[model samples]
Target: MNLVLIAMIAAMLIPMYEAWKDDNIWQKMLALASISSKAGIMTLFISVLRDDWMIGVVGAIILTVGNAGLMLLAHVIKRLDDL
Candidate 1:
């Protein structure tokens, strides 16, 4: 379990690095989206390992709402860019 968490953390860092290194707005948003997804998955994995329903629910909410919010923000940014 520790090894799995370590691997997930390492995977999450890849996007963080990309977000840091890139200046493009779309790439940064994509990287942020990826990071959000990995964080939600990691949270759910920990919840399952501990057999906690509350944490699992929180993770599920993070997964859905976080991504949806990001998509909406991206759409708004796109519209603004076009104006």
Candidate 2:
């Protein structure tokens, strides 16, 4: 379980590095979305390991809603870029 959590944390860092290295807006947004997803998954995993329903619920919400908000923000940025 510890190894799995460590691996997940390492995986999350990849996107963070990409986001930091890239100057393009689209790439940055994609990287951020990836980070959000990984975070949610990590949270879910932690909740399951501890057998906690409240944390699980929060994880589920993050998994479902975080990306949607990011997508909406991306769309808004895209429109603004077009202006």
Candidate 3:
């Protein structure tokens, strides 16, 4: 595993732990957690594809934020389901 990957996973620790403790919408939590995982993977992907560090960094940021936003969307959907 890459060091960046390790760091990314470590970053998710708090969110994952908190989400697991949250009984409501556990699936939603898991989906959110997966966003971090995907972000790391996407970063690795872009890094290997491009020699440009700036592009990789920017793309990774965008992808990661988009992933988390999807998770937030899921949360909203779950809450709406409750209504």
Candidate 4:
């Protein structure tokens, strides 16, 4: 299980690299979204491993809310880009 968590974390870096290697705003936004979700998943996994409901609740909130904010930001950026 720990190994799985490690692997998932390592996988999250791939998006970071892509975001860094390119200069596209949308791609960077996508990578940011991916990172957010992976972090939420990692948090959930840790919560499960520790059997802590508080951690799980925090993770659940991140999972539910994190991406919405990122997407809203992306939309704002897109709209600004059109102007």
Candidate 5:
């Protein structure tokens, strides 16, 4: 794997792991990671590339919300089936 890629992944995940290890840091790490995951990729290409980081940030937000909604929907469906 590329070193730069590894570095980026580390930057994004290291804080998250530290947060996971302790309750107080968990929320901050997760929130930062979630935002970073959405925005970080765009940052790599936005300057030399065509698209802006704003789109990437928006996509990330949608991804997180969509994933949570999917989980909730699945849980509700399972509950309905049980009834």
Candidate 6:
């Protein structure tokens, strides 16, 4: 279980590296989305391990709703770029 959390944390870093190294707006948005999802997943994992329902609910919310806002922002950015 600890190893799984560690692996997830490591996975999250890949996007950060990409966002840091690349200058593309799309890539940065994608990376931000990835990070958000990973964080939700990590929260879910921790909630499961701790047997906490409140935290689990929060995690579920993040998993379901977090990306929508990011995607909306991405779309706005894309539209602005196209203008």
- The weakest ten consecutive residues by lDDT in model 6 span 18-27
Query: 22-80 in candidate 2: lDDT tens per residue?
Result: 78788888888998899999998999999998998998998899999998999899999
Best by lDDT: 4
**Candidate 1 has what TM-score?**
0.90
How would the candidate models be sorted by TM-score, starting from the highest?
A: 4, 2, 1, 6, 3, 5
Q: Each prediction's Cα lDDT score?
A: 0.91, 0.90, 0.67, 0.93, 0.56, 0.91
TM of each candidate vs. truth: 0.90, 0.92, 0.43, 0.92, 0.39, 0.89
Q: Is candidate 4 or 6 superior in lDDT?
A: 4
User: Which ten-residue region of model 1 has the weakest summed lDDT?
Assistant: 18-27
Model 5 worst lDDT window (10 residues): 39-48
For model 4 the local lDDT of residue 35 reads 95
Q: Write the per-residue lDDT of candidate 1 for residues 10-44, one digit (tens) a residue.
A: 99999879878878778888888998999999999
Over 1-82, each residue of candidate 4 has an lDDT whose tens digit, in order, gives 8789889989999999989999988999999999999999999989999999999999999999999999999999999999
- The alpha-carbon deviation from the true structure for residue 13 of candidate 6, after best TM-score superposition, in angstroms, is 0.7
Better of 2 and 6 by lDDT: 6
Compose the digit string of candidate 6's lDDT tens values, residues 1-83: 88998999999999989789989888888998899899998998899899999998998899899899988999999999999
Number of clashes recorded per candidate: 0, 0, 0, 0, 0, 0
Model 5 over residues 1-83: C-alpha lDDT tens digits?
35755676566666666666675433553545564554445354443354566765665565566546545655676678679
Best-to-worst order by lDDT is: 4, 6, 1, 2, 3, 5
Tens-place lDDT digits, model 3, residues 1-83: 47766777676565666676667675556757575666656666657766668767766776667667767777787889889
By how many angstroms RMSD does model 5 differ from the true structure? Answer: 7.7
